[model samples]
Target: MRQFFVFARKEFYHIFRDRRTLLILFGMPIVQVIIFGFAITNEIKNADIAVLDQSKDHYSARLIQKLTAGSYFRIDRNLQTPKTIEAAFREGRIKMAVVIPPRFGQDFFHLRKAQVQLLADAGDPNTATTLVNYARAIIGNYQQELNGPAALPLTINTTVRMQYNPALKSVFLFVPGVMTLILLLVSAMMTSITIAREKELGTMEILLVSPLPPHLIVMGKVVPYIVLSFINALVILAMGVWIFGMPVKGSVVLLLAECVLFVLTSLGLGILISTVTDKQQTAMMASMMGLLMPTVLLSGFIFPVESMPKPLQWLSNIMPAKWFIIILKDIMLKGSGLREVWPQTLLLTGMTIFFIVLSIRKFKIRLS
Candidate 1:
């Protein structure tokens, strides 16, 4: 019994001494609670919207004011022309667009039925539906307000036009996210674990002593993952297109190139993980904590980033999967070209370069 107590005391000291273990036990829960508490939300807030109030009348202005008055919507752009609606959606500027046709107040007062078109970017079906529903509820409430003062109740007919995805298919939205997740986990996690395994088995030391240059050593370790992850991406894309009828509207060549770039970025991230950890378990844990959680929560996979608080939104900018998912959606759903997606492409490229350079530096330190 005394021996058992001493062993337990020694184990507790050992756990306290290892910062990584202490972090897994304490730091992860706090971070997860904070992230999940704030991030895992279905209710949309502060979603940017555009209003093209051609009516420009008293009622139309009042309705516009009503829409933006609450926390649900903010007017980012008051579009001058109807032609720019598609451009705005393509650029990912706004979630929904409100078009009140000419003579909206007159129609409401005289005809009792005024038409308001709600144009929603249904690329994310859930958000699109939620936005439209919120808009309709507001419109309904406004109708009631007018009816309260009138002898007869007025009607506001809302015409919902779901852009990008008229059918509001759920599969369209999940494909890009799943592809990003698979590539990230397979490329980054596998590369880190494989390299860490080499270190654990003492083969990495042998390679470090060999004639192979340090950069090549890292490249050679990650090259197989790039190929495998690319293949994995292609398979997921094929399943999305053929099995689920997901549309690929943009240039296939450009999409393939972007996939390759993302895979390389993920591989670089994995190599960075391997450089810091000698054990496979540590490498896996680091990859999951550092990469996976951020990718899911902050990358706009399941939750909308715009709906999150300001700080989480800012932190989301650092996620590679976020940029890649945007690229995927831009190409696949929006049919966006290099001109539209160049910024995200450049961001991913920069991240890849940064990861590789940092990994090489860390590897050199290990070599010493």
Candidate 2:
């Protein structure tokens, strides 16, 4: 036990003594978090739109009011004719144009059917679709108010409040994922490289032959990295909180516990990779291609997991990062407690245990 403490102390020395490693472990996470938090987002705001209200009546005016009220669309121009609307769209002053026919209010009052045309620039299909939905919803609300309930016996008004991210900001999701990626890269990828480097330098044999037990030797090599990565995690969390105003609504202790679990899981993977690959290059490549690629692409970091095909989605279930990201979002954004996120926490814990067991078994086999 005393020997273990001494080795752990040595690990801290190595981590602090190397400036580059220290910075990568600490600086990179904060930078990546800030960059991803601010730069990458899917929510659209203040997209320019044009209105062509030939009626200039109460209905057209109210419709314009609703459009402007929602922060998604902005009135860039008020065109008089169809020619002007077309010209505005052609000139790129507006990506969408709404044309309301003459006597729109009168038609609604008498016939309960007023025609409103939504002309959207389909050059960008996604933006066009969102604009159409926004316009339709706003107009639909007005139509309901205009026409007194003639109606169906039952109405289901399912108002969905996207709780954690009411604005549907992608950054809210990306911040945690990017943090997980950087943690895995630093802790798992770098540790694998370091361990394999020792083997290539023939120093691994020297360490093995030392009075230190094999497990202790491995621990000494990894402990420094663990401390370094922990510091990086803290730096990233600080940047996320300060720079992005990302709230950590859960207990800080719970957040740190989850992060440490994720780091240990990654480190176990690194140890496992080092045991499998003889060369430093092979270890690095395996870490990059085998682990990093899947974690980033398949972990629902950039894409919705539900939208993925059945097989890929099932594969994602085994990814440590996927569970980590879910736990992170629940704790940081939704203020979820241990009770709420226990399932994800348990999943991550199980992965960590599985990875550690596999690595230990592989290491024992290699020793034999």
Candidate 3:
């Protein structure tokens, strides 16, 4: 007991006293969360819009007035000819163009059907989709008031209530993804490198020859990191909740338990990598290239899974972080409980067991 405490204390001292470790442990998570929350997002606001109102009537003018009144778009340039719409799009000055055909108000009052053409830049599909939706909603609201709601008998009433993010901000998604990445990098990659360093320094042989059992030594090395990573997870969750107002719909205890399981899975992965590679440099590189890269790209952390190439979609099924991110989002955003996220929780648990067994086998091979 005393020896385990002493070794654990030594591990903490090594972590706290080292400047680089401290920076990675604390600084990387904050910077990653900030970059992800603010820098990387799908929300498009104040997009430049150009108007080509040939109608020049009350109806056309009012529609333009409504578009500009909303914060989603800004009318940057007014055009006299149809050619300017293409020019505005080419110049990238405008993402949307509203062209009101001749006699728009006359047609609306008499025929009760006026066409308002909406031309959008589909170069960025996500932004384009959002912009189009916003434009349609604004125009539809105005049309309802003008034509009377009852007359448009073919009504498509949408009762959409955004559960986790009412504003549909992208940061709510980024927070959990960033937290998963940071936890993986710090816990798995860092632990692997640290273990490999002992091998490179020839200290591992000495430890193996000592009275401490191999599993005990490995546990001693890993316990402090688990504690450190738990704190890191807590910090990110707090930031997501307090700063971004991201909802925690599920039990906080369940969320933390899932986080701990994920951390253990990552640590197991690190240990497995460390056992495979005799050199610290190789282990670090493998962790970065093999685990970190794929975890970010294939996990649907930044990119939507539905939009990914078919093969990559199939490949994402194997990525552990994908399951983690889904579970976190379910718990944090949807307020989902164990019943809702059990499949993902089970997947993570199965992966953790697999990694631990693989690492053990590899460790035995290395010892032999």
Candidate 4:
């Protein structure tokens, strides 16, 4: 026990002495969370739009005012002819164009229907779709106000309740993904590199030949990293709750326990990586290329896994981050308990066991 503490303390000293490693371990998570939460977002704000109001009536003017009143859009230019609509989009000056047909008010009052054209730049289909939807919603609201509650012949009042995230803030979606990514990078990549560095310096052989058991040596090396990774997880959770208003709807103790499990999984994978590679650079590159890309692209972090093709969906099933992200969303957003997340927890545990066994076997082979 004394030997283990001495070895663990040495590992901690080594980590603190290295400034670059300390920065990457502590600084990277904060920076990534801020960037994903604020900079990369699905919510559109103050998008430029052009208006072509041909009717020049009270209804058309009011409609335009209603569209621009919200934070979704701002009128960048007013078009006189239909010819200029394409020019506005081509020049990158506008994301959408609103064209109110001739005699819009007359048609609305007498015929009980009016046609308004929304011309959107289809280059960015998602953003364009959102812009058009916003415009339609505003126009629908105005129509509702004009018609009154009993004006329509048939009415289907559909009430929509956005369960978990009412505002649909992108931060809520990204915080868990960011947490998963940072933990993987720090725990797996850093641990692998640290062990590989020892091998490169010929210090691993010295440690292996010492009085300590091989497993004890490995644990001593890894214990500091586990502590560091847990600290990082706490830091990210705090930032998400305080800075971005993300809520932990489940038991906070359960959340931290799950985080520790994930850290152990990553550490086992790191041990596996270190057993295979002899150089720090090789381990780092392998960790990034093998772990980072899959975690980002296949983990359903930025895209929906269900929306992917069947083969890709099957491929995504193997990504640990996919399960972790699901578990996090369920816990943080849905307020789920252990029973709800047992399947994912079991899979993560199995993966951790597999990695640990593989790494131990590989280490033994190397020793032989």
lDDT of 3 by residue, 196-235 (tens): 8878887777667766666666677788889999999999
Assess candidate 4 and give its TM-score to the true structure: 0.96
What local distance difference test score does each model get? 0.82, 0.82, 0.86, 0.89
Best by TM-score: 4
Top lDDT hit = 4
Badly placed stretches (over 4 Å) of model 4 are 364-368
Candidate 3 backbone collisions, by pair: 249-335
lDDT of 2 at 38: 79
Expressed as tens digits, the lDDT of each residue in 72-150 for candidate 1 is 9999999999999999999898999999999999998899899999999999998999999999999988988987856
Q: How far is candidate 2 from the true structure (C-alpha RMSD, Å)?
A: 3.9
Model 3 residue runs over 4 Å out of place are 149-158, 161-166, 302-315, 364-368
328: Cα error in model 1, Å:
0.8
RMSD each, Å: 15.7, 3.9, 2.7, 1.6
lDDT of 3 at 319: 88
Q: Tell me model 1's lDDT, rounded to 2 decimals.
A: 0.82
Which prediction has more favorable lDDT, 1 or 3? 3
> Which stretches of candidate 2 lie above 4 Å from their native place?
1-10, 56-62, 76-94, 122-124, 141-172, 278-282, 333-340, 360-368
Q: Which 10 consecutive positions of candidate 1 have the poorest summed lDDT?
A: 29-38
Whichever of 1 and 4 has more TM-score, that candidate is 4
Please, what are the lDDT tens digits per residue for candidate 4 over residues 174-284? 889988988997789888887789889878777777777767777887899999999999999999999999999999998999999999999989988988898999999
